[model samples]
Target chain A: MTLEITGLKVSLGGRDILRGVDLHLEKGRVHGLAGESGSGKTMTGLAVLGLLPHGARATGRIDLGGRDLLTLPPRELNKVRGGQVAMVFQDPATSLHPMLSVGRQLTEHMRHHLGLGRAEARARAVELLGKVRIPGAEEAYGRFPHQFSGGMRQRIAIAIALACSPRVLIADEPTTALDVTVQAGVLRLLRGLCDELGLAVLLVTHDLGVMSAIADEVSVMKDGLVVETGPRGQVLREPAHAYTRSLLDALPGEPGGPAEPGGKA
Target chain B: MSNTASGKTPLPGRGPEQARARRRGAHPLARFLVRRLLTAVLLAWGITLVTFVLTNLVPGDPVAANLGQRALGDPAIVAQWRAEHGLDKPLWEQYALHLQGLLQGDFGTSQQSHRPVAQDLAEFVPATLELAGAAILVSLVLGVGFGVLAALRRDRLSDHLLRVLSLVGISVPTFWLALVAFYVFFYRLQITPGSGRVDPALGGAPPVTGLQTIDALLAGRWDIFASAAGHLITPTLVLALYTIGLLTRFTRSAVLEVLGQDYVRAARAKGLPGRVILFRYVLRSALVPIITVAGLAFGSLLSGTVLVEAIFAWPGIGQYAYKSATTLDLPAVMGVGLVVGVVYLVINLIVDVLYGVIDPRVRLQ
Candidate 1:
């Protein structure tokens, strides 16, 4: 089973934001889309999830478990979202509904998508929280998002994404808002969840260091196009494109000398 | 991080202990409630003092206003009346006496009615409340509905139409609206009853609640209730229009702002049904400002009722206050001002409590 995107194109307000883009993410692996800001990395993930903003249009084929997501009607697409293909957003601080308890927010999607009873959903929610290493999962269920630290909140967010045991997960800049010390914990959690659940993950980030640590396969994107696609080791060591080399060189303490500062990578 | 990673508990430190100690101290909601209640009490006293001072400042002779032409003809009678009412005392003494009387629940006797101000309020305040309550009900129902509609259809023709309609509703003078309502509904259409609380045909049912429509219902007098309700329609509609306009505008903007938040988009991404997303996420967040505006609007509606009460000749405190103001009945004016201030503070306190309930972050803070 795999989540594949072919020739994805997204235009917002009649302006092309993402030109033709292709990505392949498989079960039991994390595929990282590494790019600079405004390089359309997040848009690619949004396109796969059919979450383009109002007035934005996408022409693409998003294949998930042999079903073409782009062709599915809204009703059918909704069944896929939060059920078979869920997403972890960039900012945990704002991604959660401020008014809802973490437990209610966690259980809502499972109840709606999986038809789980309230009791069953509650039990599963606590289990999911535990899976994310939340302390006192039962007590945490009654607490709102504001009560949690940023790292813990992000862990809860990941638990929400994994509520229905979706085949594919899209984590868009999942650790960008977190402190450097806390970032490793969240990255580790995502990696462990992938390995244990055998879930395919599309890990989008601008940080090459994050991609190097977590991603098995990496796609280097520049200006809405994937410049290089290979195993993380090969691409980092033996760069194929000038943009890819600059991206690697941009990393702190990376060899091959720094390119012209402020130049577009 | 390593402590957590190693699956061992961290060493005891001041940070966590301090946080726990803080949490164990006075709960945030309790603290907030205590602070708000103290403020409300202080504010009520301040309002009473200000109203008393302002009434004293106005250029008018309370003795003349009370005694009418008799004060001009007989100086001895005027002096006796002023002394009896304690108006002969110094301003500071008058204020202290007034404050003492207020503490004892005595608002003083009205110059016009010669009845205790408190008694007049009891007879009139209910009528104003009934009218204002009905108006608020109408405003909430229509305002929230139209606001949600406009927000959902933002920037569309329907949205533009609603915006223009609310603009006109807000700009239209309430007194003028009451007049126009009388002209059209009472004069031309002849659909609504023109004036008074109830028709004389009903034999004026015994006052229980002091609200005619309600009292009529309780007495099972359908004809009286119908007549009372009909009389209420024009004034209620006029009063409701302004609130509806304000609420609709506020609700629309608030909902629009909430709909644009990142959390709303996150809700959509969770595959929540559009209806669920709209109500649970967008509307819930939008309700904070709406509740605030609704509370403030209700306070203003109480004041607005004076003009409406005058036009309809509805026996409410607003009408009493208006007549008292014209006759320079300082005690009655002060009583009305004090009541309005108290109502405003109470409503604001309720709104603050509601904010804490609706949003836990507020309570926790």
Candidate 2:
């Protein structure tokens, strides 16, 4: 395991958001965290980064390569963030700074973590842009976020998350805001990056179809707790928990039917 | 899924919107600016109409006010005075004549000063602009600074203190504040110079921009600048107090809102240092609203300086307008009205231009 969580609990304003949650993500694999909204899947990802909203409290162990992130000093945690465990969020439109150019956003953390000079950071930013399959990488450097389409903006966001060459990536509903045609491209890119970078990825989404596409291991969460965990095939094919089975039943078309293109199973 | 096979096709990032947005980038700013300018010109003409109509509608008798009772008793003198000021003509003809003169850069003659209204404005406007400019600068610096601090330390001692201070700032009456500031700072403390733009002893700077401080600097007269600056300190503070409070409240809320945005979270998630996140992510994003508020604050400061100017003896358009209205100097009143109207329109235009500069999205639309 590149990252491990044991007995993670989170609460905010006297309300429990996550209750004794545990997850393990291995390097070179995609761990899909499937849940409905407010099920604490998003909260779980935030907790790992120590980026919970103000007034929220968390107690648990987040072990990243034997270093406990929960106990790490803020200064140390700052280095670990973007440097070792970067994140890509839902709604790329809001995730990227509107005023800043794509290249600047990509290079800002690179310079911060790697101590790269201006030229070095620029080169790396362009290269990362290319890696994300963004066309006209050189010319795209100076364009603002509003100039890009939704899918293109998400690609830029993914490029930024990969800027610092982090060991683990927590992608929260990375393709939720994207169109159906665009979703497959992003998912394929995430899957490829996981293998190419040998990085542990925690993919948080509500779409089971997305899990089927790229996730190797699947964890189903409901109401702040994981209800079941297994390989992608087993969780989708034979869910042990009643809630997980109900979620599958909620999908369109008949259960055990062959999945249709551009349609959910 | 069957769609997965088609989804394998390469998807270009660029879309119609992107192409359109890119094409728009070339000349939209120039077009936007030109459109705004044309609108401002039309509004300015509209202002002239309103001012002309409103002054004529008022029950004041400019002829009696200027001629006095003894002169009004003589029928010949009254007729000549009326004819001289163009009051003898029909209202429409008088408006047509005024518009024609305005196009020729004439602001008519001031019944009080007996000089051209434009000349009177030229002499007095600079003082008000100087005071308002200084006050706005001071307010922006302190307001935005304290506002960001308040937001960062929200619900803490500093935040509470600033909130209360801002509340007092907003609630306090301007005239009363001006009076108190004058008495306390000038009479009791004697630290700041009393009313007016410069000490009578220094005889002021050679009028270039008409702003004493800048004119003095242009002439390289440090002594004059210092004296002018000293005189400016009290009134600027008095005038800025309300705006500082207004801006502080506005900026705090704006910054707080930006802090809640997803980009701020993304900045932190990228492991940016606390300072970087605050300055680059939080404050930069917060600037759009702050700029908006600041521009309005500046407009109000320029027009709203009457009470402060009265107490400080600063020669600005507000005081000119007050005297003009009191004496029923119709031409002077209209001129001041035009100036005020143009000031607002110009400030609004500036604010729009600034929005385009700060947020590219503004320029495109």
Candidate 3:
């Protein structure tokens, strides 16, 4: 399944946050949404998931697997959420319900969307945890989110998003809160999941390095508008937009050292 | 590798040694319970002592109050009465005697009615409990319901209306509200029966339960039960309005806070229905504060029944305490104080235990 968002616009409190954003994601690929803070990257992700805050109005088309999410009723939209599409938030510490056990949180989406019984949901929860490479998945199920490390918690969040076999996964800065080493592991895990499950991932982040690490295709957003988008290697080597070049220049260490970024020396 | 790495990090004070130490000792909850129980006992004792001292310190001679004008004319008779009642003894000696009587389940005697304080409390405490319990039930249902509604419809007309209504409910004095309720519901509408527990025409039930509604029901006197419940309605409503307003405000703020949390958004993004999200995630998270407020509101309602009982002529501890205060019945006043203290302690304990149940973090701590 492919996730396509076209001409997405969002306004909050009479102020336009997202002017006109567009992006596309295909199965078995990672689409990086790279932008600076307040560039509407997160807003685009929220609009796609229908998770905009109160008094915020969104317009335009959000097509997920041939369904127009922007036009879908809330009841139908809910069926699409976590069933056809799911999201992993930036801060995993706050993403999972603090009071609930990991197992319960993982199984809740599956049980609600798939109408799976307790036994079936529990089995799938364990399986999802294992897929996320959480050691001792069965024991980890009974543990709360606080018991896990930052990287582990993000993996659990990903596991929950994957519980119902969603076609599209919106990972909003999934590694931003982790250590550098943990970031690589999470990025690698997401990359592996995209290939293994043929999952189309909308990886929203402000870090161009992250995009270089895993994104197959990249879209550069600035002021709620997509400035440039193309295959990652081509976009990085010969950027059409000057803003993309500056963003690459702003990355730490050597500025514009080589066309191939995120490569270890 | 992740597990081994995490395990290798020294947890500082949370290692296996500490876990073993915890295993050998009483559980945290057990220790907490024991500590709370001890505090409750000490608090109850302090309340009794304070009540005893304050009552004694009040300007007036218990002997003269009891003996009327006769004791004023004869010093010998006054002395005799004081000695007989142990009032002539040292204050500490009298306190010791009071404690001795309390240990034996004695609450002294009412000066006005010449009845044992214990007996009067037995008759009155249950009535107040019944009234406060019913009032709390009303408050919980209406307050929590309106609170959630206001939160969900935040900044809307319905929210504004509920906020104004709760403000009015909270601001209006209980006595005035009770009178208005009586005038409107009983006199004008004729929907509810007049005051007192039940109609004197129905005689009385066997007093098996002390609570008129309960005893009447137990005795199979539906007419008496209906009449008693009807009389209870105005007073209960009058008492409940304050708590309803308080709880509504509390619950609204609590729910609003929880609704803003990231987990609530996650729940919504998970495709869970709005109703399920509200109840399961939002309301459940908000319950800690609501429960704390509820327990406190109930405690205040128990003590606040004085004006409501006086206005409605409900035969509850508040009315009895008021009567005892006017008559300088120190024993009865102290007895009421002791019971109220114990009731407050018990309610707080229940609230704490409920906190553990609602939030596992509290229980684990």
Q: Lowest summed lDDT over 10 consecutive residues: which window, candidate 3 chain A?
A: A256-265
Best by DockQ: 2
Ranking by TM-score: 1, 2, 3
Over 4 Å off, model 1: A256-265, B1-35, B68-75, B90-93
lDDT of 2 by residue, A1-265 (tens): 8999999999999999999899999999999999889999999999999999999999989999899999999999999999999999999989999988888899999999999999999999999988988777897897788777777888899999999999999999998887777788888888999999998999998888888888999999998899899998898898899888888777788574324322552
lDDT by residue for model 3 (A151-225), tens: 888989999999889999999988887766577778888999999999999999887778888999999999989
DockQ of each: 0.45, 0.47, 0.40
Where is model 1 chain B poorest over a 10-residue stretch in terms of lDDT? B5-14
Better model by DockQ: candidate 1 vs candidate 3: 1
Note the B-chain TM-score for every model: 0.88, 0.91, 0.91
Q: What is the i-RMS of every prediction?
A: 4.2, 4.7, 4.5
Deviating ranges (above 4 Å) for candidate 3? A179-181, A257-265, B1-39, B57-60, B73-75
What's the lDDT for residue A5 in model 2? 94
lDDT (tens digit, per residue) of candidate 3 on B1-365: 13322324322222463376378697755665776778888988888898889888999766656677855799898888777678889999999999999999999988788899999999999889889888999999999999999999999999999999899989998878988998999899998888887899988788887888899989999999988888888888899999999999999999999999989988888999888888788988898899999998998888679888887788899988888887777889889988988898889888987776666566555
lDDT of 2: 0.88
Which ten-residue region of model 1 chain A has the weakest summed lDDT? A256-265
Question: Candidate 1 or 2, higher DockQ?
Answer: 2
Tens-place lDDT digits, model 2, residues B1-365: 11222334233433564567568775667877888889988999999999999999999788878887899899999999888888999999999999999999899999888999989999888888889889999999999998988998999999999999999988888899989988998899998888888989889888889999999999999999999999998888878888999989998999899989999999999999999988888887899999989988887787669888988888888888899999999999999898888888888888888888777677766
Each model's lDDT: 0.86, 0.88, 0.85
